[model samples]
Structures are given as C-alpha cells and as structure tokens.
Target: MLPALSEKELDRLEDLLITYGNDYSVLNLAELNGFFTALASSPNRVNPEQWLPAVAGGKVPKFKKPAHEEAYTALMLRYASQVAEELADDPEHFEPLFEQSEGEEGPTIILEEWCFGYMRGTQVAEWSELPPEQDRLLKAISLHGLEDNFELLDSMSFDEHQACVPLVVEAAQGLYQYQKQHRH
Candidate 1:
C-alpha cells in the first residue's frame, strides 16, 4: 500500500499546518492524516473552498507569508489527490498516517482527533448512509468518533482500543473501497 506522505513531507506538512493556525493547527499530524484519508474516497473533488475555511475555524485565513499560502495549498491538493489515487489502486494495503505523529496524549487522543477529521471531512460534501457492505466500517469510525467523551477512558477500554488499532486500519481501508464502488 502506498503511504499518503513521506516521513519528511508529513513532518514538513505538520510544521506548516501548525504555523498557519486554525483547525489544522489544533490537530496533531495523525489527526490531520486521518481527516484527509477519510476524504480520499469521496465521489466529489476535495473542495478547498469548503475545507480551507473549515480548517481556519469557519473564517477565511490570512497567511503571514505568500510562500506559506502556496505551500499550504499545494500540500492540501497533494494530500487529497494522492490519497484518492492510493485508495483506488490499493485500498486494502494503504498505510495509516497516524504513525507519523508522536503525541503526549497517546493513541486514544490521536484516534479521537482523527475521527474529528473523518466526521468533518465526510460532512464537507453531501452524503447519505453508507452502503450496507460498509456498515461495519461506518459503525467503527462512528463509534470511534463518539468515543470522544469529555472524561478519559478507564484502563480496560483504553487498552481495548489500542488493541483495536488493526481493525481501525482495516475499517479505514474498507471505507475507502466502499466509497469508491458506490459513488453517487
């Protein structure tokens, strides 16, 4: 499976996002990856008009430098285009982008933030219920997203989700396939 971004690109992208400030800045690199991955299988082209403002917290962002603006736009376009291509060519093997990040709050937090991106990305375009074939994956990502309770998880569930990581990876791939096959 193709990786969404090289380690260096991922690091550079993360740094750029953080420097720019907005929803992108709030999320860690893993979350950023998860969000874009979710959007990869969308039937529609990833709409910069919609996402730039969303990433900027619903307001138009003004970049400090023209170079930063160019980099941000180029990086986002590459992310969307490359992810879709990867999902189409090798959905089963596409690597998850979470490993690029090393956050203090650990995997759970990363998972939670990733879902935030997933949920948000999916909503950027109009969509209905997923196909019956994808129900398991839908439920998995939805449940994972909802796991964002204000309180921290107790020890058992925490380990459970950590162990569930493989399933999450598979589900994400399944989701990519489902979206591709059932395009509206």
Candidate 2:
C-alpha cells in the first residue's frame, strides 16, 4: 500500500551518500524512507534470478568470492564518489530527490511512502530463507542511522564467511526481491 522508489532513485541516493559522507539530511531521509529496498524490488517484477546478480553487483561489492571482496568495496565506494560528485553540482535534480516536505515545512508523503514500502518488502523477504548476515547489511543501507561495520565484516566473528557482509547484503536483496516478484 505504500509508495515505492524506483531502482534509479536508490542509485541516485546512494551516489549522494557516497559523495556527501552519509551525513547529509537528504541521504538519511532517503534511507529512512526505504528507497533502496524499494528499488531492489522494482526490477524483480520483470525477472527474478537474473536481476539479483546485476543489482547485487551495483549495490554491494562482494557477492561470491571472498578474496575479491575488498575490490568490490573499493568499486562501490568509487562509484558512490562519482555519483556524489555528479549530484552535488546539479541543484535542480538533486533538490527534488531531497524534497520530501512541501513548502519547506509540510508533511513528507514521498518519504513516508518509501519507508512503508521498504518495510513491507523487507518483511516479505525475511520470512523466506535469505542469508542473515547479508540481510543485516542491506537493512543498514536501507535504514538511516545504521552503520556498515567493516571491521566485523573483515574478521570472522562467526563462521568464516566466503563473501564480505556488504556483498551478502547485496546478493540477498537481489534474491529476495527476485523471489517476491516471481513467486507463484
């Protein structure tokens, strides 16, 4: 019942975070609004298995091999930086992305809808068999105030993970959204 952000919107927000150091109010608003999760689920209506791998590659750096996980993180950060730089210069484009309140002091309909949609979609995914570690990371990304603990990911507090936390998060979101859309 909640409105959702398209995949493109999440990508834009992520880019904003990468450039603005994740401290910007707009970035926080976007995450709090559940833009990323909504975006993840958007493509699933079209294809399930195929879309998972693709968006996973874009959102999280590591999905499969552990050895290359660092490279994946670097790539994600680099992409985020590029996106941030692009977004910073374009006030017209970026302002709307941040514009949840009307007339500068009204209710934030888009943000509220985005949050609701994200929660619904994520809950649906959690009921299924998605990886726990990955789900945690994705939740961090989708929700404001959640941090990505690189230290925890780098070390093995639990079973030795083949994929880094971010990678798993990305892959799980992909799989969850895919399954949600394609399920019979």
Candidate 3:
C-alpha cells in the first residue's frame, strides 16, 4: 500500500496552496490533486507549462511563485505514487480531493474546478483514444452545468455530486490502468 503524505506534510502543503492566490482553479490542494490525477491518468506525458494556462481557463497567471511550485511538486510526487498504488490495489477506493472550506461556495464549485483541471490535463496530453466509458465520464464532468445555472446551484445539495463520485473513480481507475505502462 502506498501511504499518503502524512497529515503534517499535507497540512504544510495545504497552507502553501492556500497562501498562493487562486489565479487558476489550482490554488487549493484539492484542485492540485485534480491536476495531478488528470496528468497521471493521461496516456501521454504532458508538460506543466503547456497546460497550466489552460487550467486557469486560458488566463496566464502573472506569477509562478516558487513556493507554489514547491508545493505542487510535493503533491505531484505523492499523488502519482498514490494513483499507481491504488490502481494496483483497489480502484474502488480511489477518490479525488474535493476540499470543503467553511463559508465557501457549494461543493459543486470545487467539482467544476476539479473537472475543469482534469479535462485540461487530458487535452494537454493529447489523449486521443480514450475508451467510450471514460470519454463519457469526462464529458459528464466537464458539463456539470454549475456556472450555467447559478441560482439553482447556490442551494444545490451535494447528493447529486456524491452519486457521481463512483463513476468518476471508475473512469479514473480505467484511465490509470490504460495509461499505466506508458506512465512509468
């Protein structure tokens, strides 16, 4: 079993991400987790510089702070190992990070950010041959209709999002397996 970064390590990393301004949806550790997870599951390696801007919704962040880079590197190493180990063990337990902060917007907002990152990663990798199920899941994630219907989203319950969690995991696990040999 690949162990997660300890609470202390995670805490420090989380703080680092939180301190970094949310230029992209990539500020919080959860979004970073999304970014790394998408990269690992891609069939080809993607350069960070190529896709970081895409994840930011096409906005080039003015700054690439070293501290943010360090924090991101830490999560990448840890999350990639975790993905490999999890795919080898039980993909059923695989879960993306979707952090919930007090007084924050609904959980769906993070879902959009995570999915947005995931889709951007796939695009950057030029993963052209995703199987149908995985493709369906990817499309589903990218079109959650969060921003399209904000008034309803403001009071949306998380139940719908929770229901899709398994599907997301299954798709991620599938992608991981399909890309495993190419990854390492």
Candidate 4:
C-alpha cells in the first residue's frame, strides 16, 4: 500500500496548488479530498492523465524543476490510491476532509468545497445515468456541493445542514460499496 501523506507533504501540495494562481478554477485541499473520494468510488477507472490536469484547475502546472513536478504528481497519485484503499477496506471509517471554521456558536463543519470537488469528480468520470437508488445516493453529496442546490440549502438552518453531514458521508460509503459490487 502506498504511504499516506504526512502533514508537511500535504502542506507542500497545498502550496503548489495555491501557486497555480487561478483561484476560481484551482481546487483547495478540502476540494481535492472530495474530488479524489469520488474518483476512488467510481466504478470506471479514471486515469491520472484525465484527472491530474483537473487538479491544476484544468491545466497542468509548469513546475520550476522536473523533480518538483514529479514529486507532486507522485504525491497526488499516492493520495488518490490511499483514498481508494481506505474506502475499499474500511468504508465505515472513511472520512472526507471537510473544513472547520469557528462560528458564533462553535466550530462549524464546512462541506461545500469537498462536495463541489466530488461533484466535479463525477463529471470528470462521466458518471451519468445511474440507477434511481444510486442517483439518490449521489444526491446526498449534491445537496451540499452543487450550486443549483444553494437556494434549497439556504432554506435550511445551520443545525439542519449540520445534521446532513453524516448523510453525505454515508452516501459516499454506500456509493463505494455499490460500485464495488457492481463494477463493470
């Protein structure tokens, strides 16, 4: 099994992403986690050739050194593999890397970026026309991730959105199991 990314490595990856300079298009760490989780759960394999460019906001970054580029790419591939292994071996304990912010009440869990990343992954994987049951499972992530659902989400109170977090997690795990059982 590939080693998990250390905190320092993770930070370095984040820095590399930040250096990409297209804030609107580039994904952050949380989004990358969600994106990778979706790809990991996908029934059809999505190669690095397809997904790696998306990591850099739809363009491959031109690193200063060939070694630096190789290192970051290797790190990303390893992280993606780590996500897949965790979901396959221990879906129950799999966790999405959501952000936490201190709200007036307390620390608030933010699922937006992660969810958005996941939805993007689905798009990249071309996961279209799933069965109703599977579509339902995907919806759990979409509710929190998609821009189209913002109005609906806006209608929900903070507590309500907070309550839905577990549902999203469960949905991701369920999707992984479904794909595992029904892989083509």
Q: What is the TM-score of each predicted model, taking all chains together? A: 0.78, 0.23, 0.65, 0.93
Q: Taking the tens digit of each residue's C-alpha lDDT, what string does model 1 give over 1-184? A: 3346677876777787677666344345666666677777666656778776665556555878898888777776677677667667788898766542444546342366666667667776655776676777766665556555434334446556676577677888988877777665
lDDT of 1: 0.66
Q: Pick by TM-score: which candidate is best?
A: 4
| Collision count for each candidate, in order | 0, 2, 0, 0
- Candidate 3 has an lDDT of 0.61
In candidate 4, what are the lDDT values of residues 55-167, reduced to their tens digit?
Answer: 77787887898877988788888888878888888998888889899998698999898999899888888886778988998999999888999999989988998998998
lDDT of each: 0.66, 0.38, 0.61, 0.85
**Which one is best on lDDT?**
4
Q: In model 3, which residue pairs have backbone atoms overlapping below 3 Å?
A: none
Scanning candidate 4 in windows of ten residues, the lowest lDDT window is 19-28
96 in model 4: Cα distance from truth in Å? 1.2
Residues 1-184, model 3: lDDT tens digits? 4468877877776665555446544565665566667777776776656655554446443546876766656554675566546556765566776655444444442465566556656766777766786667675555542355456445656676556566665666666666776663
**Which residue pairs in model 1 clash with each other?**
none
Model 4 segments more than 4 A misplaced: none
- Give the TM-score (vs. native) of candidate 4: 0.93
Worst 10 residues of 3 by lDDT: 101-110
Give candidate 2's error at residue 124 in angstroms: 4.8
> What lDDT tens digits, residue by residue, belong to model 2 across residues 1-184?
1223346654654553444332222234343234334433432332323322333422333235564454434433343333333333441233212224443434432322333334443543343444675456445434422234445534542323322333333543454445445554
